[model samples]
Target: MEPDFPLRKIIHVDMDAFYASVEQLDNPDLRGKPIAVGGSSQRGVVSAASYEARKFGVRSAMSSVIAKRNCPELIFVKANFERYKEISKAIRQIFYDYTDLVEPLSLDEAYLDVTINKKGNPSATLVAQEIRQRIFDELQLTASAGISINKFIAKVASDYNKPNGQKTVNPEEVIQFLEDLEIRKFYGVGKVTAEKMYKLGIFTGRDLKTKSLEFLDQKFGKSGNHYYHVVRGIHTSEVKPHRIPKSVGAERTFSENLSSEIFMLERLEHIAQELERRLKKSKIAGKTITLKIKYSDFSLQTRSKTLPYFISDKDLILETAKNLLYQNSLENSVRLLGISLANLNTERKETINGEKEVSVQLKFDF
Candidate 1:
């Protein structure tokens, strides 16, 4: 194993059930109670679940029906993204106070490069504590922080403790910490990858370290290289403050699954129009249009086509989406339909109301 990497300080900050926490903070009645933020309708999906709800096996991305079955008393509250966006901006400002090298992963989490911070603190541990403390004092919110030499380890460390806590792994302790970690706990190693590793008897970081780079590359392509380096504490990814979004999309789940061809076409038209608005609002034109369909039985399929030129017009989006839909036969009733625009042309800028919008800082959900 190579241990020649430079020692850089990185911190990952993650909010504690951010959406649910905000709901609880605004309403005194919800404190210490099991609550969820999102719809409870049959077609609704849970966006965030409080720690109490988590104990009942209620999780984000789960169908509302399933969440209710898991926790009969779970209180479902609607999500307020506008409010969440305000808090996220506040939290990001706090990160910027310490370092400009902050990379936000989502509305509730970010990674900050703090090797030499604005406060001149040499200890990343102290910086992390101060950030968490400031968040609580200023926002009345609890956050967990992970401190390590890179983004991967720092992110993992942040999850080591719950609601309000911090964990720091020193350079000397990095290897040992990763070695004892489970393969499933590794970033980017989802269920499918974990199952593959399990079949190869690689259950832990130690087991993963037993394989050579060439062997891993042959088995898992580029991802095998990522796993190989991270297991040995060699993640060199920097904390980028300005990361461009690769795609923009919007989708809706229906209260009633649609089976009729005409009904599906109507839904696609709505989805395409919404997608066009999103692309225009973001000042991005995409060459690739993708249509996603989720069947009532939970099966999912997607069809995409690359256009000759970038387009963000409603008519073009609708026409392309209609063509894609007609080209493929519907296998079953669809529960949800979505349209996305990818292969974005970031170099282009648009002038709306005399102001030039150059880049899109993504903060939309549909």
Candidate 2:
């Protein structure tokens, strides 16, 4: 670890229960209540749940029925993909105003490399605070921000104070903060892996860091390298700007496992809607629609269908996705379902008769 290396300023911005929050924001009557954004139909799953609902064990991806069971008073609102996309665009515009080095992780989350910002601000913390305030004042939404010397730490810091909060991890505090963190809180450590780590007596960053590199590599394969570095607060990934999106997708994990096709289709429709909104906002279309299924065992599979022409229409995308899901037999109860648009239409902008035009062409890399 190069403890004396020059630091890079990074900020991670995430919206608070994005979909549900947006719903509440649009209807003040729903504010401060246990709310979820998604359908309440038999097959419906949550896209997002408000903090109020979270207190009742409601969470994103949980089945609507289970969410309602967890919180009997839970309010379910149909997701509005178009509206969410509009707000996402506004938020991205604000990020660009500060720095062009913006990398969006999703509609509601992004990383801004403010090492050399356009505003010439020296403190990333101040910039993060200002951005959060602007989002609240202009959009009537709450956002959480984390500032640190690198992307990994910044992302961790942001979640430290969620829902209209900001947290900063200065260079001097990075090591100590990471050392004391629970291993489960690390970015890629999911529930199953966290349990395995606990069984192995590796409960915290410090505990994991104490193991030899070879031992960790033997245990977790390629991801061991990531755990090794992140535990020591060392990460070298760069924030790529305006990188062409390789795939656009949305997914929901259910609280209770689902086995019925009707329920699964309902959840797929919601994800399809989200994918369409993203495709339109990015001004990009796709030739392939992929359906992802996660079984109750946590095993996952993806099935894809490629169309003859680029498409961004909601109905077309959903139809193709439904076909793909049917073609791939569901062998087990599903815990999560996702839809993705891939093999994007890559065409450079051109002017035809003084008007901007788009031409479709295929390019493949092996």
- TM-score: which candidate is best? 1
Scanning candidate 1 in windows of ten residues, the lowest lDDT window is 357-366
- What's the lDDT of the predicted structure labeled candidate 1? 0.86
Residue pairs with backbone atoms closer than 3 Å in model 1 (clashes)? none
Q: lDDT tens string, model 2, 1-366?
A: 234333688999999999888888889999999998985845566889999999999988786778888899998898899999999999999999999999898899999999889999888898999999899899998999989877888888889888789898877677788879998888779999999899889999989978766788899987776777777766767676765677888888786799998998888888888888888888989898888898977677989888999999989988988888889678899988888888888644432111111121212110
Cα lDDT, model 1, residue 274: 87
Give the alpha carbon lDDT tens digit for every residue of 1-366 in model 1. 223444578999999999999999999899899898886745578999999999999999888889999998899998999999999999999999999999999999999988888999888899999999999999999999999888999988898987799898887677789889999998888999999999999999999989987889899996777777788777767787876778889888888889997998888888888888888787889999998988988788999999999999988988888888888899999888889988889743422121111121222110
Clashing pairs in 2: 43-263, 61-253, 62-255, 63-255
Clashes of 2: 4
What are the TM-scores, per candidate, against the unseen true structure?
Answer: 0.90, 0.75
Error of 1 at 159 (Å): 0.9
Model 2 bad stretches (over 4 Å): 1-6, 243-366
